[model samples]
Target: MTGATTLFTGRITRRSMSGLIIAVLLVTPLEAFAYDNPIVTGTVPLRAGLLLLILLGLRTTRITAVEAGQLFLAQALLSMATWSVLLDFDPNRIAVQTLAYGTILPVCTLLIAPKATRRRWAFLVFCVTLYPAVVRLTPENLGLLAQVIATLLVHGASVAALDTHADRAELAGEMADIDPLTGLLNRRAALNELARGVDRSADDQRSAAIVLLDLDHFKQLNDTLGHEAGDDTLRHVAHVLAAFVRPTDHVCRWGGEEFLVVLPDADEALAIDMAERLRLRLVDVGVTASFGVAEVEAADTVTSWVRRADDAMYVAKHEGRNTVHVARRTDRLTVERPGALGAP
Candidate 1:
């Protein structure tokens, strides 16, 4: 299977595991209650183990923030409803149920929810499960308020700790796919996007273009104006490219002094126009770049398409900077340099 199919299958597996674990946790207590088997204290440990497994499985799967939030909410409601029915309105069991619902459910949800939405989801779970329990406490049972308070404190601290972990994981993922200097997609992410674009173009019978850009005299600027200024110039160029491109386009920092723009559904003429527009925009910022444009072809692979653009870019560099070159798929060896007919 392809990488995408594998990823999709893995995600489905993780989600299935999560659902199974949730079902087991929810049903196990009810089963013990139904059978009146007090020896089944293994519920906690079993649930804890399953929750850990689900968390571990999530490390490789991608779940959206909204989905995570919804999962937490569902877990909270299921736990509350299950405990309420299993305890059969016993006042003595209220404290135990409160502790379990407040602590276990929030911990599980926080572990699964996205870091950015963890706190909100935690608070939501708490209010949904614990607040009602606290409100239902009679005046004669006021002493149980202390247990509720302690559980709240523990849940709060757990959410904070889990949120910290989520933030760190998110930051690591971001750093992996992001170029620090220009804030554009890094090489690995760009290649992934290229593969996706190739698939999309092939499946839809539409053309896509790759524009390879190299800033002219970037090395001289770095030498004379210091690396900081060169960094700023790179960022400015990135901004210009981003501003000029459509939302369907992707911009990536291919490497030092070079950037790649992937334009979906664009033909050779359209790609040349985009490159020229980008070149003119950079000129407004007192910088110039060479652009190599190539359209996708029926038999073209990612490497061949990018190499075509790279070859055209070299032609632009040779002819003179601040120009655009077109490399068509029909002519692999011919580099349509700037000033050539139909060149930008």
Candidate 2:
């Protein structure tokens, strides 16, 4: 729904900007004739043709919104400069142009710098829009001074409004991806990330693995200790998993008391070793978790890959809990218990 709304809004914005440009093109010739300025009249054909070409390019080419806005803004600024020169820098006309761009340019700057460089670009645009009015400022035309103040206020307001909106949108997206209880990636977000990781692993011919951990006796803990203690245990387990994993790894609450940890660039051996370490760490926190480790295979889908790890986890639970089991590519199982030979 959000994607559809964004697409619809983009179409509307494109059409509106196109319509505005065409309207300006249609009006330029009328203004040239009405003013009867020799230079304006003489250059009408050339200027109109240039604008029409730009509009045509906007329609025929694939360009981002920022690029399109920039083309239109460049044309508008050029036309304003041309008219001012043709009219001998008429103070009234310059003031009008300054006011018009003071509004238009800042909006375009919003499109141009939607991210980190927004303030820098806005500052530059505000100075550029203010240049003409500054040169025309005098005691007699102190209204130009008023125009400067208005431009500054408008520019500042635009930046503040956009920053607030962007921040909220970002926060909302993060919240959507997070688990409410554990503050880890929820099942849905984890699956999406796993899919991407699988694709990357296939493309790069690198190894990737998933460790599925299930807290032992979690239901009994909830029933006996009450739900609050269960929730605390879940949060504590999530923190330990997060702290134990490498920076490239992903820790997710895979529903209920099950957690999935994605390990990129790791083989079966590494996966089992990591799982063993995680089991020991959970024990340190006075919690015991059954772990299953499965390295990704060439023909494995995300579902099948996670299923293999999950199957291995159950094997650990069956082997008297608090142990790690590895899923080999051939679907063979190696039950690894703590203190076993070749075990960490």
Candidate 3:
């Protein structure tokens, strides 16, 4: 799924944020003019009010976590400034402040993260669920009715622009996460995929596994033959790894001389056996690597499990290399255990 990810729309949220800051900076004169001239109260304030509404809309429609994260940061800055400037901020005077500030901390959380966690998405879900109640509670004659209506319309426009941007950003991100050399998934892309898989498994009641591979004596090959030959060796090994992975599964270059395989629906025993086969297949492919296998437990997360798998691979390296070691679970999983080749 992460073979290609879009970077960011750079449209709705970024543009909106910029426009808001600009309008807010430029509107002091308007605010003063409106304050002095009673006749121009309705008309003169329109531009500033319209700009604020548009900004709100832009903030509302972001789809990516990074965008969400940046938005939250922007809100925090805006919120603090607004609070400090106002002599007595009240619902009547700054009614939407409640919505503006309340949404900031959580939505800011969403934007800071590259991927949305269950809790973060829950916040969005809450907003979605509570929208009907929001409409019901605020009637047409409510405080700042005109401003709220304008804000809603702006929100709609921003959302439309946001969807367009998200589609592109996801694609850009995926592209960035690819290993340019061998067309394999890069570490970032793989991590994202594995995390997503764990989420899916949790939601659907399934299983998954992660295998780590390290090419034994790979440094020797580079030292003796040349870096070019070593690269060719790695590429060839990548070809073997690609063949072993299921269409649904994925393989990634987990940095120098290391590869990670994400296997969905494979348990500990089965994953260990699969690792043995993968280890042997490298021999057939004319390159060899020490193998370490780790399974995703009911309680495991992508980060913890990957670290465990990496630890197991190191154990395999320590035990004379060229073997497979399955990560054992203790109170704390330490891949520092003695390595041994086992049943395939």
Candidate 4:
């Protein structure tokens, strides 16, 4: 779900940027005629065309938010430099241009970095300071001091507001990925992580594994102990699983009483050992779970890999619950050990 939201946000941002580029292209011809400036009449159209091409590249590519923000900032700076050089830094023209971009550029900076850090603040200060210095360097341009100062204040305020907004957006995205009951990642987020792990394992030629577990006779426990007890049991199990996994591992509630753990850079042996330990831990806490371990294969898709693990888990249940089983490469599961709670 978080991935989908990010993709949607990226599409919206790209479309908005494309629209801005098209608007700029349409306005350039008018500017050339209205101003009758040889540079605008001759060179601006070519620059606009180049910008349009860059916008098209943006449409065809996948880039991070920071990268896109940096690209936009680079183009803005290039445009400013072009105006400064071609028009001989005419104070009136440069001042007007600088003020026009003051807000837009700072907002772009927010895209590059939304965190409130000293380095980021320093960069913004440099940008805000540059235009005023240029305007004030020419004695006659001193008359625009009030306008420059106002622009600086406005830019400062906007940065604070924009950074706060970005923080909230990031927090919301994170919250959307979490399970309200277990405080673990939900199924969608888990599947995304598993897909990434599979791709990484395939690309790097490294091993990865997954452990799928389901509470044994959870329906009987809920029926006997009530729904509140079931909720507490789920939360307790989630906490135990989360605490046992390594920092690099991803633990997720795959729904109901089932949990999935993605172990990147781990082989079959390590996965089985981890599963045994986890099962023992649950038993120590007066609960039992069935665990299935499956190592990622060379040609394995996320779906196939998870299905193997799920198949192994059901095999454990069929053999008697609270057992551990390992899925063979050929899609068969062999029971490793009888569960502590077997046949009860």
The TM-score, computed over Cα atoms with residue i paired to residue i, of candidate 4 is: 0.58
153: Cα error in model 2, Å: 9.2
Better of 3 and 4 by TM-score: 4
| Clashing pairs in model 1, backbone N/Cα/C closer than 3 A | none
What TM value does model 1 have? 0.56
Across 173-262, the per-residue lDDT of candidate 4 in tens digits comes to 879889999889999889888898788788767789999999988888888999999999999999899888886788899999999988
Q: Rank the candidates by lDDT, best first.
A: 2, 4, 1, 3
| Local lDDT at 308 for model 1 | 89
Writing each residue's lDDT as its tens digit, candidate 1 over 149-210 gives 67678768866886687678867886899888888888998998889778867776778888
lDDT tens readout by residue for model 2, 1-344: 01011211121255566776788788887778666777878777777787677677666545544556667777666766667545765667667667777766666665556455655675678677767667666566787678666766876787678767876896798799999999898998899878976886787677888899999888889988999999999999998898888876889999999999988778888888889999999999899988999988889899889988887887788778899988766664454442342221
What is the lDDT of every predicted structure here? 0.71, 0.76, 0.62, 0.74
TM-score of each: 0.56, 0.55, 0.49, 0.58
lDDT: the better of candidates 3 and 4: 4
Deviation of model 3 at 94, angstroms: 48
Instruction: For residues 44-103, write the lDDT of model 3, one tens digit per residue.
Output: 355445445445544453233345335434444443344424334343434453344334
What TM-score should be assigned to candidate 3?
A: 0.49
